[model samples]
Target: MTAPPKTPHPLLFAPAASQGSVPDTEIGRLFHEMDWSATPLGPVEVWPQSLRIAVSIALNSRFPMFVWWGSELVNIYNDAYIPVLGKRHPQAFGGRAREIWNEIWPVLGPQVDEVMQHGRATWNERVLLVMERNDFTEETYFTWSYSPVYDDQGGIGGLFCACSEETPRVRVERERDALLQRAQGTVTTLQGWFDNAPGFVAVLRGPDFVFEMVNRAYYQLVGHRPIEGRPAFEALPEVRSQGFIEILERVYREGEPFIGRGLRLILQKEPGGPLSEAFVDLVYQPVFDVHGRVSGIFAQGHDVTEQVRAVEALKEGDRRKDEFLATLAHELRNPLAPIRQSAKLVKTPGLTAAQHHWAIDVIDRQATHMALLLDDLLDVARISRGRLELRMEPVALSSVVASAVETAQPLIEAKRHRLSVTLPAEPVVLTADPLRLAQVLSNLLSNAAKYMDDGGAIEVQAQARPGAVAIRVRDNGIGVAQESLQTLFQMFSQVSSALQRAEGGLGIGLALSKGLVEMHGGSIEAHSDGLGRGAEFVVHLPWMQTESLEGGQPEAPQGQAALRRKVLIADDNHDASTTLAALLELDGHEVHTASTGNEALALAEQLRPDIAILDIGMPGRNGYQVASEIRRADWGRGMTLIALTGWGQAEDRRQAVAAGFDEHWTKPVDTDTLQALFATPGRAGSSQAGPAR
Candidate 1:
């Protein structure tokens, strides 16, 4: 038997020179080696025209194509389809479709069977395909089509498939999903930090102060009430009346921070909860957006109710202490008058030389010392109670320094201390009381003199600066200790050693000076390079920017002292009243005395004295009432009323004015002061150009 050599399938071979049919692909070469006559489809030339045409189209195409041909529905695919078949290539190229695709058969069998059995076409977009590739099942997606091919009988023979894998696109979406999860985890950790913070923190958006974010502390602060995505006023209505709303709006508009310490606010946190008072130290800071515009506010603070309540509890004790100091000052002045009177009385012409020297010593050493001590105590008490008031005027800083230097010159000379003063050539103007301003400088100078070695040098430098004037009183004396500097300006605060205590002050000179300086809208600070290294005190006062002084000290009134006038004096303290009357009579003025306010009123009506010095604390009617009565009388209208009181506080002076007094003086009113009042040319209720010191 002679076996004829098998002819290879024409569609799989390289295109011949005349035909130009087969593609140059792996599948093309494999198709020529494939024995189709032994399989169900048989040889390519004897195959039905429709089947042959389908095979020709499948093998020659460049796309990933497959042809399921003949009644057995055999598998056929191109070179582009080998990657999709995975390990099933070559063997699957000629096998039955159902047998080759057994793993994904449930999904692919119906698409194939419908097209082949019913002669209909089927399409699938992004269909799932679990296929073994490289000996492992891979999760893949594909877009595929199955179109029917007809035999010569006009019946469905097989399905032609065009397919593509969508695996790469699906894998990218999974990676994106993982990234989103990680971002959410980071946000959660940041939110956890905010929740556990100690202070109440909240973020509010816009000028409305709407709560956009809140933490655990903030929630507990409002009694664990839910508050978010709502305006602060609407969520915490109690804050509206406390001006919190206004502060928030202002901070948002101006981009400035608003702080409130111990701010009392009443809130009803829970339903039916009683309105409770809360004191918080809160700050409203502006929060800007990415565009650099203020978009919200960051509210944070702590509750301070306990601290505020403790301060409120101590107010009554403070009041009683002030009263005790006032009484102590009044009692000390009682003995001072007799000592002063005895000193003056011993100065008579008949006295011996020894008695004269003794009297002079008593006057110089005892009386003056006692008087100054008493005055310092009274000044400190007044300052502590906020009773000191400044009579402000714009005067040259040079003039003020000059006056202050004069006040301290006596002590400076006694100590043989070298003093130098540097003033700006251009005048520096400040709105302050010339008397108080001078007192501030004098106190610092005296303090320096007392603490330093006897001959130490002191310098007073006044420099002009923008918006303020810096007056520095520096001394090459015993400098302050580091611990003492902090309490130097506190009333009753002293840090002198045993030897330094002999300076004979109440340790309140700096304290009083600080009070007066502050009242004039200035600040005082103490600086030192440690003990014995020299000290410097700098005082800065807000200065007026003008070429000239607005107002200044009034000049002394002269000639009126020689003019005699009738005066009425009244006092509950007999020694004070008689000594003052005797002093007035020494000035060649006729004087009358009364022990009570009623008696003074009667005397004023009866004698119609030119001047009336009414004692404030007297039996029966008070001096204020007596003054009121005297002013009502037609004959007493022209009388010059003066109020004398141990109570020389600002309020007391104001009351004196209300009572028709021309001037007011505290006790221990020196004879010179009394004489000066009459010398100033003015009646009651006139301008205080030059009154008693």
Candidate 2:
């Protein structure tokens, strides 16, 4: 059996010096100086050996340590544990544990009781505790362990605890975790923005420019290839020689961004497919790592191929327009020189009759040439503006061919070219604008004549196709180039400047002919082996099924009868009014002239003229006002009103009729048309007037 331990003598157990001498810390000094007679644990000098040993250990500890001794569970802590006590330090040194930490008694009571009653150790990590150490209750966390303390007889005395406050570290960890979550959310939002962006976006990593991240538009730009994670050049081998790879590498190496507009690239569009041209407005921006070094490039751009092509086309059109203007000036001046010289020659005093006649012929021919040029220009304008009206009529194809040959005979014979005409055995009939059909054929003949060398052979062949009549004009001289065939009929387009200039043309005949042919629901095309290899222009017109040519013909106008009438001519131009009056007077009609609207009205009222010709632009009052006033008068109501003016637009003709005019004629009016007007009834000697034009 073990021997029972005996208690030492009081003098031997008690401190020989002061109680404060046993502990070197502040808590030790306070404990020794305190009056413990009033506590259950009694005086410090009479305390049990276990309680003294534990108190000494607690007071000397550097780490936070606390001792709860005897039945009252009085508090005693080290210097490091003072912060946990807050303002309860000196008082809590001798205070009961329950009272000092009453705010947290619910949590602390079980752990303390387990260690005290069972003599078992209790361990708690990061345990929450709420204590009223200061004026306010504070939230705190501590990692601590409680171990039982024993007295001299081996019975449990109280609990000794070792602790560390973990409040600051726990709060720091929580804040760090929250920031990481927010950072991840921001990254996801940024990725979403990139995916939905309108322009193409891509990310390339490393020196090989490997595609890392790409958006929806980026896939479309590259024809939806599975390119992500692949090197750019390896995915699009066609772009290897296109210099895009070099550009991206340069941006990465230089750490600078590159922006390009309308940059050209040749791409395959599909795997192992033929290459096609592409244009883009792009930017390559270098991405940097934390060390301030370029790690990759961000590629973003638009496929601007259509816009670039449109801009290029516009530039070409502008250049062509400039060239056309220059050509127009040159052509217009060419005729003026001869006309001026001929007029001077005709006025020479000693000129013979033959010489005067020759001079007159030269002037007439040049004037007609100028008129034709102006007519072509006006026709183009009217067609472009959708104001030209075609007179539809049923006509035999033979008649149209005869009319066209008659009109083009002068040019054809002038070139001294041998022409062959071939037509299908069956007569071709068409419901077409007769004059316009003849005009289309005449233009083709003239074009053929102009492009060929003198005396070149030409052929005009017509055959009946399934649904149409095909007329082809073939020439053996200066054939059109294959490349120029596509743009041959474009307005003001010339195959070659030297050829067109030498041939004396304004470069609009083919374009005008094309417009006229298309207006008749037909198509025209040109074909040639190559330049100098001969060429052919083919015209296709819709066929009409007809039996005999009995009623498929327009009635010819009756011959003008020899009738004299009183004529009134009003014009602001003296030369125009005088010349017109002279022509009508020579036709045996008594003619009067007026230079203003007021004069015209006075003359009409005084003479009650059979026919009144008025100009739209006049002083005091315009022709519309004069015509309106004339129709309101008594005797003037029976007179015929004719508007002869320079304004020839469809709107001008409508306005002329609205102003009570019987006819609207654009100047310079054809002499034959004016003669036809004079032959109408109710002009001085006739019974009744004809219908208004």
Candidate 3:
């Protein structure tokens, strides 16, 4: 043994143990114990100077560090890197880098090759690595750097690495980023809602009340001025004197909210324009900072100028109504006084037969005049309340004209006006309410007679036009002023001069005529040059061709009987169902009724009725649910489903249609309307009752 020690080769000799070349650590001890001859780098003593220095540096570092050397890329690491290795620790101390980290070799292999082949350094931050640790793959993150170690000949020999696990910090940062994204999304959504808010919304900041934010409605209220970032009082100087600025100041100073209801403010809506008054119902809520000190104010309100003006108009209307009532009383007393005198005269004894007859005629004429006035008033009221029912039927234009002329002949002859009637040679037929049309025509003719001077020329003409007929009533009379034409068809509206000349009228004839014309899907207009220029009233009515009227069963003709058919009524209210069933029975239709959605479905399946009128709000499943279920059945596919609900809003109709209903009808639907539905062509005795849902 002494001879062998004396003969030891200097090239393979180990460094002195006392020299402490290796780090005095766990990985250092393992590195010292590992046999380096098995690796491509061979023994530690034979390692190149550059690699020795790199390994020494890696083993001594406080941070996790590693060394990959030689063509095999053998692994060498410090004590700080042991936890990174997990169960591969002691065994992985001096093993091949790619073999020891084969699971992540694909990720790190290229990076190592780059540094080794190019002699360049590589740095990566928060690089993700799924590594086997504690006998299980763990999700971890790390930041590391790889620098080439040069040999004595200035050639790349190995890689020196320094790293730190970033798993906890990286995960925390990712979570924070996700939270921030959600918060940002919420802010964006809130901003959208604020911009589209219906009411005027604004925010003011600081004691000067600078405009910080404003919505679309606010911009409209303020006339689109460039007011953002400017002081409220400075931008809207018109509002300063109106006490709006003071109100905002008070809210900001005292931190107390103020609700202003119908506050009147005079503003200059346009630059250099006249000041106008506006009313607003608003609230000034103080916004506080972190210290609970008032920072600004939030303002939201509605422009109530129309409401204020409407209240004033209502007051004026009440005064006008009072005047009208007084006039009515005086007019009524005038007729009553004459009737009383006539009655007394008839009752007097010793009166001649002629005198008695004259007195009786006076009473009769006055009573008839009073009855006429009451009838006009009643008609006006009924039309205003939408209670006037039109009995629509096929009628000849000649017949309507004759009926009107007969009604107005007494008035025309009494006025001694020269009248002319002209019509198209070919007879014109229309689907119209004959009586209503006659009434409209007669009212115009009577108006002409009443307004015209005696012996004035009156002309009634009817001409055919595409899709309509034009009926014109022209008269040489005390014509209406241009300003009066606009309101001539309004209720209780009359030209003052015309009223004076005509002696007496309720000022509703033209209004009633217009209403009647509109109910027939027509329009009426009056034209005149000016006072004493002769007025003309024209009515335009939609007309049907003679062939269509004669060939087909009347389409939606008023009061026409419907074909016999099967009908189902589903409603929760017993009275509504019973009454509707009775009406259908009267219309000659077989009917079945149910009070619940489920019962309706059962009855619908059993009968396969042609029509299903269902109440939207029903017990058990509701009408919408029942309608959907019925629509799924083969037998129920062709049935017409009508949604009969008290809710008649446009949204309600949309929901009903979306729920598979063919029609949406509001409660209290007219019997005639239902009859019209059944009378429609292909509505009964056909596989399909209505338009498919």
Please provide TM-scores, in order, for all candidate models, with all chains considered together.
0.52, 0.70, 0.62
Model 2 ranges with Cα > 4 A deviation: 1-198, 215-224, 271-273, 497-501, 546-562, 680-693
> Which residue window of length 10 is worst by lDDT in model 2?
684-693
**Residue lDDT tens for model 1, 357-439:** 77666565556667666777777777778876667767778888988899889889999999999998886877778887898
Question: RMSD (Cα, Å) of candidate 1?
Answer: 19.4
Task: Tell me the lDDT of model 1 at 516.
Answer: 81
Q: Which pairs of residues collide in candidate 3?
A: none
Q: Report the Cα lDDT for candidate 1.
A: 0.79
Span of ten consecutive residues with least summed lDDT in model 3: 7-16
Q: Which digits, one per residue and each the tens of the lDDT, describe model 2 over residues 621-671?
A: 899999989888777777888899888777887788888888888778777
lDDT of 2 at 55: 71
Q: Cα lDDT for residue 384, model 3?
A: 78
**What C-alpha lDDT, on a 0 to 100 scale, does residue 101 get in candidate 3?**
87
Please, what is the whole-model Cα lDDT of each candidate in the order they appear? Answer: 0.79, 0.83, 0.83
Residue pair clashes in candidate 2: none
